[model samples]
Target: MQALLALSRAIDRLNTFVGKYSIWLIFAATFISAANAVVRKVFDTSSNGFLEVQWYLFAWSFLIAAGYTLLNREHVRIDVLNSHLPKKVQIWIEILGVILFLTPVCVLIIWLCIPIVAERYATGEMSPNPGGLIRWPVWVALPAGFALLLLQGWSELIKCVAFLKGLGPDPTVKADAKSAEEELVEALRQHQAAAGKAP
Candidate 1:
């Protein structure tokens, strides 16, 4: 049990690290998009590669951050009747859901994606659009993302079981950590304050 808890913590750490870095993909995509627009407008031309790369970056960010999102408990859920349930009951429901639904879905997706990714890579599949990027890199994200999500599902399952066994704290309680939106807003406020202080 302790070993499983340790594994869960490790998985949590891995996802946290991945989540922290994955956010940069969004910035990269944004920068590429702006640059592509500027080039198209000023130079009267743009490479499909540039445009496609933006999509790639966004896709990578979204897909690879699955485990991180799960770790942070940021995924959408309805609590209309859930909040009224007993804590243990809620945990039990979560355990069942993870075991019955999340695990199978993630595994199936990962299994399905593996062969596709391999085939694309093996064939050196390129985008049909001229000057666009290769397809494999983006294709790889599907399996990679779902694998992370699957690992996270197991991590969450471990945590849920540990809590049920009185070996750990409640797994469903939201930590006091600031959400990504909150952090972004705070940074913007700081930047505004700094600009105001400037000449």
Candidate 2:
């Protein structure tokens, strides 16, 4: 239990770092896109591959932050029903979801995307953007994202098995206090996302 708690703490600290900066990346991407738009409309001179850059930034932002979100327990949960189930049933559902569903999905995506990205890289596929604008490879994100998901999935599986044995989830040893800083950050994120804004 202590070992699990130590591991979870390490991951959570790493998660805090990842999650904190993820918003900043989103902000930077949004700024880049807005600047590109203004340059095109007002100055009539903009990046040739700005649109593709936007897509890649958005994609990378979401995918790269996947594991951190899991570590924070911030992912959506269909717990209205599960919350009412017995402890054993709850563990089973969680185990099934993590092992059978989440892991498989990530594995399949990684398996499928790696080769596609390789083909693209090998052939030097360029975006349709003007000026022969070259694209940074989108392939890197796929394998990286899946790898993070896989690690977190393994962590969750271990903790869940311990949980089934009544050892509890990740043995979160930290005191559960909601800090003001956390609340403020969350509030701001919600506000920005809702307005199609980023920060």
Model 1 CA lDDT for position 104: 93
Tens digits of per-residue lDDT for model 2, 1-199: 7687567556657656766777876887898899998899999897757767677777777887898777666677777887788777876777788888999999999898888887887888787757544443666787887777777776676677787777764322223645789889989989888889543
Per-residue lDDT of candidate 1, residues 45-130 (tens digit): 98999989999999999999999998888999998998899999999999999999999999889888899999999999999999
Determine the C-alpha RMSD for candidate 1 after optimal superposition of all C-alphas.
Answer: 6.1
Top model by TM-score, which number? 1
TM-score of every model versus the real structure? 0.88, 0.74
Q: Which runs in model 1 stand beyond 4 Å of their true positions? A: 177-199
Which residue pairs of candidate 1 clash?
none
Overlapping backbone residue pairs in candidate 2 total: 0
Q: Per-residue lDDT for 198 in model 2?
A: 40
In candidate 1, what residue range of length 10 has the lowest lDDT sum? 170-179
